[model samples]
Target chain A: MKRVKFGTSAAVLAFLAASPALAASDVCKGSDINILMETVPDTDALQAVKGDFEKEYGAKVNIEAVNYSLMHEKLVPSLTASTSSYDVLIVDSYWVGEFKTAGWIKDLDALIARDKVDTSLYFPALMALNGTVQGKTYMLPFWQYAMGILYRKDIVDDPAFQAAYKEQFKRDWRMPATLEEFAEVVKWAGKYKDMYGIAMAAQRADPVVMEATNYLFAEGGDFYDRTTWKPTMDTPEAAKAVTVYADLINSAAQPGALGANFDDVANTLKQGKAIFAISYLFLFPTLEDPKDSTVVGKMGFAPVPGKDSFLGAWGWAVPSNAKNPDCSWEFLKWVESKDVAYKRALAGGQPTQMWIYNDPEFIKKWPAMSQVGTALEHSKGLPIMSRSTQLVETFAEVMGSVLANNVPPATALADSQDKFGRLVKGDPLLK
Target chain B: MTTATIRAGSPGRRRNLAQYVFVAPAVIVLALVVAAPLLYSIYLSFQEYIITYGMGDFAGFANYLAVLSDDFAHVSWVTLKLTLLCVVFEFVIAFGLALLLNQPHLPGRSFYLIVLMIPVLMTPVAVALMFRLMFNPSLGIVNWVIGLLGIPPQGWFGDPSLALGTVVFVDVWHETSLMLLMLYAGLKAMPGEPVEAARIDGASRLQILRYVTWPLMKPVIMVTLMIRMIAALKSYDLIYMLTQGGPGKATETISFYAYRLGFRFLDIGQAAAVSFILLIVVTLLTLVLLRTMREN
Candidate 1:
């Protein structure tokens, strides 16, 4: 009995000695965490500043980056396991619903409250689209890609071309304000022998879906009726959007547009083979890189030619089965802090915070960022649900058919709408 | 019974137990790695197993019915076309090359053999990427070269009418080398007596090839075709890296469709059902080939 009492007292003393370290943020010290990340500029910026975090917390961070096409499929197996191989997951905006519904990612409300994270600092669209689902925060906004028009300033700004444009259209040449005007501009630009008009990424699966969604939004159409939970892709507006998108590809886009993805579009613009591209703002730096781009200083940026644009963004989340949840949370807090956000923005990564966009340094460095900031205010994100993958893939296939096989937009979309409706109906959350 | 006989019987029983003990690990490993997962997948095919939400209600044949009602017919047709085209073309090219390389007095045989083996040695994904770049409509060397002849630039992998043919061309390039090596090896292992007899009887080279060499090489040819056909049926990597089954699903095969269902769409039950259907098709083809082999 005496021996047992002495052992108990010793254990109590040991616990007391370790209490402070366990409670402190330094609890991340010596912890090793792994993150699944997408191959994007934001991830590059994170890698650049990783040594600072490692030194500050005495911890190790391992990031595995994969191309966007493979990111979701790669994450699924790991996330579904009882103990995830990844401590942190790079959550795309559309994945929020599925992740939250599956309980694969931890709810960050308590953690945010504990850390006093200023969630309001992030763009409301990013916050709503990327991390927050049904009033619960599950992720921290990492980076955002606002869709916009990138063009050759030299070609558009030339006096001779402007004069020719004025004569042809009987109006002064300016940035297009509507989809019809955009198509006319694209068609006019295609008249040059040396240049194609637009570099479109129209590959079947995700590329075309992303590019087509802009048209869908600008034309006042959506993938589905939110309130009724019915597919809206077969509407007249949706058909018109698809027809315009397909017409652009057939008449104005660079050769092999049907097989091109975002990278291909970037390359086409960089090679000076195309005059403009409907591209994500995240690709701006890549276009400006002197080593790869032939049209580095010749390019200009503007918002898409309509009120609505597609918003692309990613967020960081701690997986529910993370072995080092505290360390993961610590990493998220540090990465999403104002200082880091500023650093990331300066490193040519897209900023998720409103403050970063308004910073004087950023405003001076990237005049185009103001346009991006304005675009973000009105941009729309793809509908988020557990069945978004099916929705996007089905729509992508339909767009592909319209572009590749010359199927009428109405017929293809009608078929897709019927198929996608059945797929969505199977979603338990919807039911 | 005699005491000696009883002792001998005891030793025989002990020997049998020792054999089982030695084989037990392999059996257990096979059961764990191969049989267990396969059985589980088959079982899951009968249940509504969503990846996000764990296992749900018993689905019976609904998953199969659902998959069949989807893109099964189109993908099957594509897979069949791809397999037949690849196997037939690969056989013709590989057999011709094998014949040429089999000559005893052929010049630079070793150099030619090494050159032919390079594609076989290459990884499929790397080959696909290399070909994708080379076939890029705007920037690729292929279009540039064809331009010199005044032929209009073709959207090789981007055009729906051309995408499947382009994939088959790339597949043939990457796969025919392996077939060549196999056929060449078979030719080398062939008996010389029949050919010598045919030549002595005034049989022309073509006649000898048709009658003697063809008959002797029948079994090897069947096995090689069977192997190549099975591989063609399971083709996915090249399709993924080259075109991603794109241009309006023009090149999508059964294997890719199954992958899209499971990984991209996260419909595990339906994906499993598709895989089981593919397994059935492959099994039927393999049985037919085996039966042909037995008859031969």
Candidate 2:
């Protein structure tokens, strides 16, 4: 080890101090690590950063990216096998509950403490919701997502429409802040020739469930009672949520809302058709894309009008059977660090840090930072449970019945209860 | 020399040994690929097999009992209807087109046949997505063309009442080509002498088609029907890419239901039980077809 004395050598030391990944490379040794992630912007950003990390710590990284739908199929065999294939795994937040119960993940609290990593730098709510399972930090927060109401600011900002809106509703025209106001906007804007009130995924699939969950929570309803491990989707408020979801889909949303996903909703906004939509934060970047969007610099986002919006985020965890656990931690620490996360955010990745949300630099770049912060604070992540995945699908079918057919919301929810009850029967997990 | 001295058995034994030698590799491959998973599935059907938890509790007959429900009935009925509907329409259209192409001295027949058979070349997922975009109520070409006659924009797959039918239409669009190729080939192989003789004896085209052509086309139609029915029963890609058995399970067939159970629900035991039921249904269908052939 050599000591540098001032000036030119000091300049090199200052640059090294700026990059946490480069500085931390000396603390840990290197080996080969295979990482698993869904094919999303997070995967792209990680791949882009792979070269830098490999050079910093002499580790070869093999990244396996799969479509989101097939992630479970790809992960199950690897996790259940006697030997782990992937050293690092990115887990959808909902699966964290069961993963924790299975004891297939390494507890990272000691690692963070030893490395003196400041975990509080990340969003507190998401860190609590996604990373902590059973009061233990098993995963590090990566890309965070929250449901929001993205609106056509250009259209709403027009004086003609604003005057007409005020005359019709006896109030100022603005983005909706509550479910009633959301429905009213849907009805009010639906009569226009060019714009629909909202864009939604109301079909008989996963999209409907994702959209409806926000409504369920906004109305102060929930899917399960944690103490009893029982479903609660058939409650009066839940039933009302279903009805509202259906009514909005039928009268206020875009014509193809039935089978449309978030991509479609964002695309509709980009094409200058829809006035508003409730979707994840990833939709924001596409709206800013110059080549694809017709509504560039013309859209805005707000916290969805509800008690709370829906939240989803994926995080990196070291499999208990990791072949190179130390190298995996080194890569994970580098990716989740302040400098790398900031860089990743600039390159089409959603940053997970609390400072990134409040930073003056990012707030200037991101138009909806304040509203995003509010949404994150109010948002609720999907339930962490043994059968959480199926519960989502089951509720979707129930809600689909409400929207697609003329099934009464109450009846459809009851039918859903029946179906889910059959699933929960004789389950060891629930017991 | 030692092999020759080993056992000179009867001709029956020698023939049996020869048969075993020829069939052993195929049997071994089948056991490894097909029979192994099937046997494991049967074993798994009796246990609560969570992928995360490995093999869990053994609840005999519980999985089988759990799988028997109204959901199963609804899915099976949807499968039955879709299979029957697609097979009927595909056969009728394919047979009609085959007859038209089978005409004497048709110009550019090869070119027409090649053009008509394009759908089967593309993947089912691609075909389903193409139709999904085509039927998009906002900007689909379908509504644009139909709007010329003042028809309102139809929901197509989004309408619970019309979703299954719309799905069948997509399936027909992509799959009718297969039926046509098969039927056309069969038409060429059929004897023309009977039809020629009937025409010379003053029988009309309709009469010749009904009596002469119908009898000869039965076997071909049956084979085509079997192929189409089996394919329809196992249909997943189009439904997954289009409606996902949605708009309220209108297009939810047994195969999709079983997949949702296994993959989505993580109910491996119940999923295996559902698959076993489908296997039985297919076996019964095959038996009935074979019996019909024997009787006919």
- What is the alpha-carbon lDDT for the whole of candidate 1? 0.86
Clashing pairs in 2: A203-A258
What would the TM-scores of all predictions be?
0.95, 0.90
lDDT of 2 by residue, A221-313 (tens): 887665675778679988877778888888877766776766668767788878878887777778888898998899888888868888988
The residue-by-residue lDDT of candidate 2 on B1-296, one tens digit each, is: 66565555657678989999999999999999999999999888898876545577997988888778548888888899999889898888989999999999999999989988999898998898799889887668998898998987777877788888998999899999999999999899999899999999999999999999989988888877887787788888888788878887888889998888887777788889889989888888788778767766
lDDT of each: 0.86, 0.79
Worst 10 residues of 2 chain A by lDDT: A1-10
lDDT of 2: 0.79
Tell me what fraction of the real C-alpha contacts between chains A and B each candidate also makes.
0.58, 0.54
Best by DockQ: 1
What range of 10 consecutive residues in model 2 chain B has the weakest lDDT sum? B1-10
Superposed by TM-score, candidate 2 places the C-alpha of residue B33 at a distance from the truth, in angstroms, of 2.0
